[model samples]
Target: MGYFVNVEPGVNLYVEDINPTGSKTILFVHGWPLSHKQFEYQFDVLPHMGYRCIGLDWRGFGQSDKPIDGYTYDRLADDILAIVDALQLDDFALVGHSTGGAIAIRYMSRYNGKGVTHLVLVDSAAPTGFTKDTADHFLHLALNDRPKMMREVTDSFFFQYATEEFCDWFFHMGLQAAGWSTAAVIELLRDENVQQDLRQIVTPTIIVHGIHDRVIPFSQAEEIHQQISNSQLLPFYYSGHGPFWEERERFNSLLMDFI
Candidate 1:
């Protein structure tokens, strides 16, 4: 159940759609430096529960077309819109992790949450305070020493113990992305702020964040919960940036309960 959907003239995003005939659908947007594969744990179980799970790789990442431009949040969100239209998806729960959550926010605001029934943000990297210097430093690392940069990201990804094999797998996923595209997204992270977009959301929203998250602090998730009118905050006490994998059972249970 995997295929490519052309989001634009020259770009086609890779999508993994499981249990396509399920009554309930959930669309997953993965975080930065990773692709739809990041939801491997969720995909393994959700489909068996009679839920249709759809995950997509952002342009320039995973199996998607890599272009030099269109890394901005607006354009990224537009890509999601194209997929929705192409798949004719309706009343589906939208789940996004880290940077993906920020993109989901943009999609909700920019497209008026078209066909979205529920919104889930997991350890979202939004309401950021990133500066130009931060972006430049990360961009430099991405272009010059991507392996080192990805290793650092992998080290801080989880609070629980991950096997050496797991860490290697995660690190390689980041490396699979185009170097320029990785830098472009770092710049997007530096420039974009979705606080206003969060307020504009009328959809029922859920913010699931790790209590000990080092990348994006717990405070940001709290702030996001406060901004969204119909939102609830669920903190993953024993997790770090990746609750979906770090605490897969609990995360899946919460997601099922919410949906």
Candidate 2:
């Protein structure tokens, strides 16, 4: 079942919890314009592996409240901390994907990872920040033409040869996010590079990326691995952006081993 954790006045974040009684918990933060459902594949497998799994949908994403503002990384990090505090999660692992990775980096650096032990980043954005060309292009699309951004990105970057059924679902999930959120978050992520914060991560870290990822280039993963001391980098050679879905068997196996 899922519960809404209120992070601020009139804002409740949606979170789905599974196997809550398990000894160790894994909190999953999703990428841009998606929700906890992004990790549906993981939830289907992790609970049976004797690990509790929690998935959070930030403000204006998924089933959570979609206000007109508060889409910055700082607020997103606060939302995550609120869930941990509300649920009293302790000694748990944090798994963040894409933009969620940025949020996780901010959360850990600002709070020094109070209750977190292990960290996993999947196809994350680069801490060094997006190139000016890329940032300008994305910012324009986000602010001026969101539907085009959603359709093009969803088709070209999100899925590479996925079945029609899966592709449709992924596209729809992107649509579910509020337009204000989709636009605001793009600018927020572009402007807020967490390079300084990534240096502050003392917890053990592992970075995963799909070699052929177009949305966030694989070079971003290399930069993160280089910045974070002693962090492991795992590249999915045969996969693209969504490795968890593209190479489920290998990803699940690697994740189980990593944990």
Candidate 3:
């Protein structure tokens, strides 16, 4: 029930209509390296329960135009804002994974509580190191040595439970995503500090962290829950970064209850 739609000039966005007829709207944002389709589980299940779930591929990741510009997390956040305005959606649940979590957090800061009713971060990326070492690490892997180092980086990005097929699809997908400039990735990986910390976030929030998530680590989730007042955390015992894939049933159950 989802299809590609032109969201902007030269920036055709991939929009999946999870629940085109549902009354409640769910806005889902994907992590790095994957497109809007990453939230396929939510799109499939949430809509059946009467929620209009939606997900979008960040520019340069999915069907969205891999333009040379608009790679900055700030601009990416702006893109989401534009989508909300274009769709005229109000009173929706917001969910994001990995870097999408960071973008969601930034978006809330700029447009706090306008339409977002709840916030969910699944194995999110936040409250982490934004120092020289982090930048140098990502830079060396993504930009240095013909981008071959991205293989190792991508490998660690997911948990060992990830399949060879999934890993292949994920990495190759990022490469084919077109026009993902090294400078943009570096800037994103370098100045990736959150403009708005989770501590200031006051909406009803849920943090889902996979215990074996070596990518962001469960400790980061714990720290975020600790900082973000009134937020709750659900530990996924059998999954890693993408628990929605590794532990799909349990993820659906938890999300359904929360919603």
Candidate 4:
């Protein structure tokens, strides 16, 4: 079940935590304007694999605090560090998507990446700028023409990778929750591009991406694989950005093996 966690004094952080009493733990970090709920499918299936899965709702999203101050990467990364210490998790797997991916990378670079035994990046942002023009071009559509742009993104993020129902809850989450402002999300996106170099991750990393991912094409994953000295790439042929949603079973199997 999910809980209202106090990552720090007066800081109410929300986490969709499920400790199946498994020996191994996996901490799933979500991206911008979304909650820990993004990993719902993962939580449901990973446990049976003898693993405990936990997903965190980053600040400003889900039930977490959304104060006007402290939305920067340094601040977000700090929150993650706090959660790690608060929960007393160790030897866990760290999986992140999109902006969450950047946060994980930053965490590995800044801190010792405590308790992180393995890393999985799902269509995560590179430590640099991507097709900003493509994303920028869709801003008006995502705001002014939200439904239309949502459909397009849904197709690329998951529908192209799996069945229609795979992304039903994804769009539902957007409708049920108060989303991030366009300006704030745009600012986050602008900063999501990495300015620092992190091509030398010292851990076992698995970079996964869908072949048809319009957001960050497969080439981006290729670059990530080539750069991370100890990492490997696992490509999905018929998926998009949210490959886990598209091919749930396959995604789970791959994760089980990788972990």
- Find the 10 residues in a row with the least total lDDT in model 1: 126-135
lDDT of 2 by residue, 106-133 (tens): 9998888879989999888758445677
- Our model 4 lands, by Cα RMSD against the true structure, at 2.6
Ranking by TM-score: 1, 2, 4, 3
List ranges where model 4 is wrong by over 4 Å.
Answer: 7-10, 129-132, 135-152, 159-168, 176-182, 195-197
Off by over 4 Å in 2: 143-145, 158-160
lDDT of 3: 0.74
Cα displacement (Å) at residue 52, model 3: 1.5
TM-score of 2: 0.94
Please identify model 1 stretches exceeding 4 Å from their true place: 129-133
| Higher-TM-score candidate of 2 and 4 | 2
* Clash count for each candidate, listed in order shown: 0, 0, 0, 0
Off by over 4 Å in 3: 1-10, 129-131, 144-150, 179-183
Query: What's the lDDT for all of these models?
Result: 0.92, 0.84, 0.74, 0.72
Instruction: For residue 243, give model 3's deviation from the true position in Å.
Output: 1.0
Each prediction's RMSD to truth = 1.0, 1.6, 2.6, 2.6
- The digit string of per-residue lDDT tens for model 1 on 16-60 reads 999999889999999999999999999999999999999999999
- For model 1, what is the alpha-carbon lDDT of residue 209? 95
Q: Which digits, one per residue and each the tens of the lDDT, describe model 3 over residues 70-117?
A: 776678778888788777888888888888888888788766746888
Candidate of highest lDDT:
1
